[model samples]
Target: MLTVQPLQPATFPVPGQFYMLQAGASYDPLLKRPFSYLSAENGSITFLYRIRGKGTRAIAALREKETISLIGPLGNAYPVPSGEFIAVAGGIGIASLFSLFGAATGRATLFWGGRTAGELLMTETVRGLVRTAVITTDDGSAGRKSLVTEPFREYLAVNAHLPVYVCGSTPMMKAVAALCSDAGARCFVSLEAYMACGVGACLGCVVKIRDSENHEGRFRSVCKDGPVFDASTVVWEGQ
Candidate 1:
């Protein structure tokens, strides 16, 4: 977890929106990395990220008062659910969905899963905010040993009318989207892509989306058109 306070008052990012962060003044890493806002309040923004590669390693090395460049509150936000909704998060993907709990107040339920207990950051914080939170770990170190989708599928069998919000690994989102489609529920997904430009200019971060009218597929820029999209509209891999 890293928190940054801008020198000037900052715009609070809507849930599911992300920022492109470039650590330090050097351009050795070249492209900025995208991270969804964990929370934004009182001119301070927080991001939850794992040190997976060079970009993240740079971010991890920053000291207090060091300067970094940021370009966002970018991409679309998840729709505010008017009724009860379920959120499915895989590992650190919870970073994007946490604010939705506040948006829905007592009407949200969260199904969160990680490969191990260590990947499940802020579990207690999430439990405090949602109506109910079901946790699962692949290793069975905490919660159930089953995939997070298992309990979500079971829940939908009973509460099929509720909408779903999802953010996770690509495979997890695709799986959850399939389940929602089968249950006749609406599902929104937050996508991750490599971005050369955080804005739309570079055309580097595109995903296939199926046209609603003709069913033809077209590429859309994830940086601008979404990081958040309706699950049914996305042309998942192998589709």
Candidate 2:
């Protein structure tokens, strides 16, 4: 919702792509985290992040006019949904899934989960684009006192044919994928791994690939090859 400049392709972003930010002393390196593009337009990239640890908190304090260096718009996007779609997110993962709204221009719903109402992000931003935008707060502070996957499953029960997209912490993404697999719905999941470099050469973001059928071919770099991946391609240890 905050705009710093007019939209430009170089500055705008595509879904599933990410940026490596330089957070100068206004922040501690320990507090600068990589973020994926939410929705980019008018020479601006929109981002939604929770102010959890110090890094993100520092990012929240930055002034708009201040500029930062970033390297990205990397990784392939989830297969665009054809008919209808559902997106499930936890915490600020909406920053990762919100961009898919345009690609899912088909029809859609969003199921978001948070520890409390205060942690919710992108509800209005996404609701403005999709048909159903549901927010579930764990402390009963917002929409429903439930995890995001609850509504995700309930919605899928009735809309079994819908495609699902999910993003969040590792545990949440794993759970959503498991649910989608059980219901026979195709799913896509965005990942989060520690990264120092946002490109493949560093080999810093390796993840275990989980699904046998989908991961048939090879290994992928979250920074270069991903951050976004098919649910069936991740090997989640459930940590």
Candidate 3:
């Protein structure tokens, strides 16, 4: 976890938006990595990231007051739906949900999961924010000893009127989308893609979208068109 004071507060990032953060000061790790704005307050923004690679390891080694370059609040953000809101997150994907949960306030319910209890990051803050919180760990180390989708399925089975927002692995999001489709509930998914450039110029991260008018699928940049998209609008079969 890291919090940074932006050079300017006028353009702070909103939930679901990301910034390109360079891991180190050296040119060895040339490209900047994209990280979602975890939470923002008092003119500072927080980021949640695990040390999975060189880029992340570099980010982990930083000390206080260290300067790093950033590109900024890039990509589309999640829309605030009306009525009930359900949020689902897997592993480190929880990075994008804090602000959303805060915004939704009493209207939002969060279902978060990880491989084990220890992996469920920011448990205290998450529990304190949402109206309802459901935690799951695959190894039974905390909360329920089942997939978060299990509780999610149980919830949606009864409350088919609510909308769901998810951020996680592609397969997990796809599965949730399928569940929402069967229940006729609205769903939005934030995708994680390997992006070379935070902007759209690289054309590195793309997903196939289902076009209703053409009845065909078209490719769109995840970094530009969206990291957040309506589940029904995504073409999961071919991807």
Q: For residues 155-187, could you state the per-residue lDDT of candidate 1 as single tens digits? A: 999887898999999999999999999999999
Between candidates 1 and 3, name the one with more favorable lDDT.
1
Q: How close to the true structure is residue 144 of candidate 3, measured as C-alpha lDDT?
A: 96
* TM-score attained by model 1: 0.96
Index of the highest-lDDT prediction: 1
If ranked by lDDT, best first, what sequence of candidates would result?
Answer: 1, 3, 2
- Per-prediction TM-score, please? 0.96, 0.86, 0.95
Model 3: ten consecutive residues of lowest lDDT: 98-107
lDDT agreement with native, every candidate: 0.90, 0.74, 0.86
Which candidate would rank higher by lDDT, 1 or 2?
Answer: 1
The candidate, 1 or 3, that scores higher on TM-score is: 1
What is candidate 1's CA lDDT for residue 225? 96
Error of 3 at 169 (Å): 1.0
By how many angstroms RMSD does model 2 differ from the true structure?
3.0
- Write candidate 2's Cα lDDT for 1-239 as tens digits: 32334333474566777776554465366423578777777567766655657666556667878665566666667777777788888887887777678776586788888899877865676689888888898899999888888888888888778888888878888898898888888888888888877777778788766455565445678877787787876777743
**Model 2 whole-model lDDT (C-alpha atoms):** 0.74
